[model samples]
Target: MRVVMFGYQTWGHRTLQALLDSEHEVVLVVTHPRSDHAYEKIWSDSVADLAEKHGVPVLLRNRPGGVELLGALRDAEPDIIVANNWRTWLPSEIFDLPPHGTLNIHDSLLPTYAGFSPLIWALINGEPEVGVTAHRMDAELDMGDVLLQRSVAVGPHDTATDLFHRTVDLIGPLVTESLDLIASGRAVWTPQDRSRSSFFHKRALEDSRIDWTWPAEDLERFVRAQSDPYPNAFTHHRGERIRILSAAVSEGRYGGTPGRIFIREGEGIVIVTGAGARSGRLPGLVIKRVRTEDGTEHAATDYFRTMGGYLTPRP
Candidate 1:
């Protein structure tokens, strides 16, 4: 079967690689242009670069709309259109162009997490599991009929970056199997239940700010969710931005105030959380690693020499 693919970033690169390795013909590939943003991580093997390496036609477009794109697709005459991690809205002119229709590989199980940074949101929200969904493309975002879906456990210590790598591995298998089913004319479509659906907006830097008022467990998850390549969960110390790279829910706690630096020991820096005493024990978060604005990484003990102040939001 001939395929026209639309994708971007690492997720896009993986999907395109899978299609190229499969028994399908990828006639055209559409990818987003290179981003100059400092925060964005550029893939070494981008979709456009991969497509070029494989000798497949490539289009660099943020939005896969307008006449030129349509004309190119019409010429390619693909059997199906496959999209993975494509950010923009694809008009019906493109999604409806192929004979077998368009199939999208979404990071989360459809109808549940229907928006950006789903893996991060799932981890931050303390979900027990995370998965990917291959579905037929529709006008609504991630509301398509499910074709293939697989789930993986979200371990207690798992970060968003960890979940991302795990989820990316599933994409290749799901896409290959979904395409096989479609090619064999045995694909099953399951309509998504609207009642179970929830959509989330794109997360910004503001969303990564650590709120000490939250429960210690929740704050721990928040730290893990945004660690590493993502903007770390951060708070202000004397107007200096300190990004929390790793943290854990401490065993015992005594509450003076939420966000106060209560204990500074060799183990870690324990900050009291808003979850007050329960059964004579208060909740606290033990921050193990941190990074400052100057890009200096440090252990919690070294980072906090004087431990009486609080971790507060910038005013």
Candidate 2:
């Protein structure tokens, strides 16, 4: 099959690589230019570079569709269009251009976690498993018909960075297998259950702020979700910003206002949490490690030398 790939970052890089290694012909590639956004910078393997290395035609577009882009797609005459981690919505003319339409590979198990930073969001929400889904592109965001899905278990101690490495590896194989099925006319597209669908916005610096009103277990998961290589979950203490590098739920419940830097527990410092914390039945967040505004990491014990303050949402 003659293929046109639309992708950006490591996800797209892997998709294109798989297509290159397969019997299919990758005629054209479209990808986004480099971004300075916090999340966009990570897992950024260049789709354009890989396409160029293979001598395949490459087009860089922030959003798909322009007269030139359409003309190029027509000229390339792809049998199918395969996209992964494309930053923007693709117009029908672009996704529906080829005979087989578009095969979109997403990082999460669709009908849930359907938008940006899916792995991070899933971790924060404590989803038991995280995986990749290969589906046919439709008008809505990740609301496509399912082709194939492959998942990996999300361990209790797993971080978003860890989940990323696990799921990104699934792209190449999923793309390859999905394409083979489509090419051979064995593909059975399954319509997604829109009732079970969810859409999330792109992550920003503000989204990583710690909200003490959440349960300690949830806060712990939030810390793991925003683990290193992505932005760390953060809070403000003594008018200074501090990033949580490691945390856990406390062994005992504490009674205090949410965000209060209370007692020390085991190896971490316990911060009172949850809206119901005053009832003294809620476990506090045990902050094990943190990074100060100066980027110096410290044990939470050392960082909060004398606890008795609040970790605010802002300065």
Candidate 3:
């Protein structure tokens, strides 16, 4: 079948690969145009690059729903339109032109995690399960008829960056299967239950701050959620901001006030937390690694020893 593709970021890159690997004929690609020098870094791989490699026509548009975009798709006359990680709203004119309408691949289960940063928000809220869903595109953001979904377990050690890589890995095969089913006319479209829908906000640099008022386990989850590549849970010590690289929730007691340094053992430093965030348990975290404002990473205990000032502060 002749296909028109629209996608952006890593997810879109995977979708294009899936379509190229499958039996469908991708006639053209619609992607965001290059921006000013300052904004360019935020944009990932260009769809035009992939199109050129595959000998497919590429359309660079800041918005995908405009009249010019509609005219382009109409002229190409693709049988199916597949959207993935695209930033713009897909207008009805383009959707109606394709005999199969349009199918979109969302990075979460329908009616849940329905916005950008779905996985990051899931990690922040301490959710154990996250997944990818392919759905029939509609006007609403991620509100559409579901075509397929696959769940991934979020381990205690899992972070937003980890889940993102795993999700990207699944897109190649998952999208191919969903497209095949739709092409064969066996696509099962299930409407999402809007009653159960929830959305999340984007993760800002400030969102990485660790709130000591939250319990130990809650702090632990927060630490793991943003760890490594994305960002790290952070706290203030001796008036300096320190990023918590890794931490383990302890079962024992730490009676000190939240943010107080309870003990220093080997490479670890036990930091106190509140009772509520712990889900009714002990209140603190054992941080293995931390960062100083000087940009140097240190074993939590070492930083405590080297710095003369108070390592722990009262909340």
In candidate 3, which residue pairs clash? Answer: 215-277, 215-278
Q: What would the per-residue lDDT of candidate 3 be over residues 1-315, giving only the tens digit for each residue?
A: 999999876688789988998999999899876654222334266677988899998988878656777888889999989988777667777766799988888888778998777887788778878889988887787888898998889887887778888877888888899988988889888989999999766567677787777777777888877766666677778677788888887656666456667676445777767844334346457888887778899977777764223333221
Off by over 4 Å in 1: 37-39, 42-44, 275-281
For all candidates, what are the clash counts? 0, 0, 2
Q: Rank the models by TM-score, top first.
A: 2, 1, 3
| Most accurate candidate by TM-score | 2
Clashes of 2: 0
Using all chains and alpha carbons, the TM-scores for the candidates as numbered come to 0.95, 0.99, 0.88
lDDT of 1: 0.87
> CA lDDT, every prediction?
0.87, 0.94, 0.77
Ranking by lDDT: 2, 1, 3
Any idea what lDDT model 2 has? 0.94
Question: Between 1 and 3, whose TM-score is larger?
Answer: 1
Which digits, one per residue and each the tens of the lDDT, describe model 1 over residues 29-75?
Answer: 99988876423463335889899998999999978767898999999
Per-residue C-alpha lDDT of model 2 across residues 130-213, encoded as one tens digit per residue: 999999998998998999999999999999989999999999899999999999999999999989898999999899999999
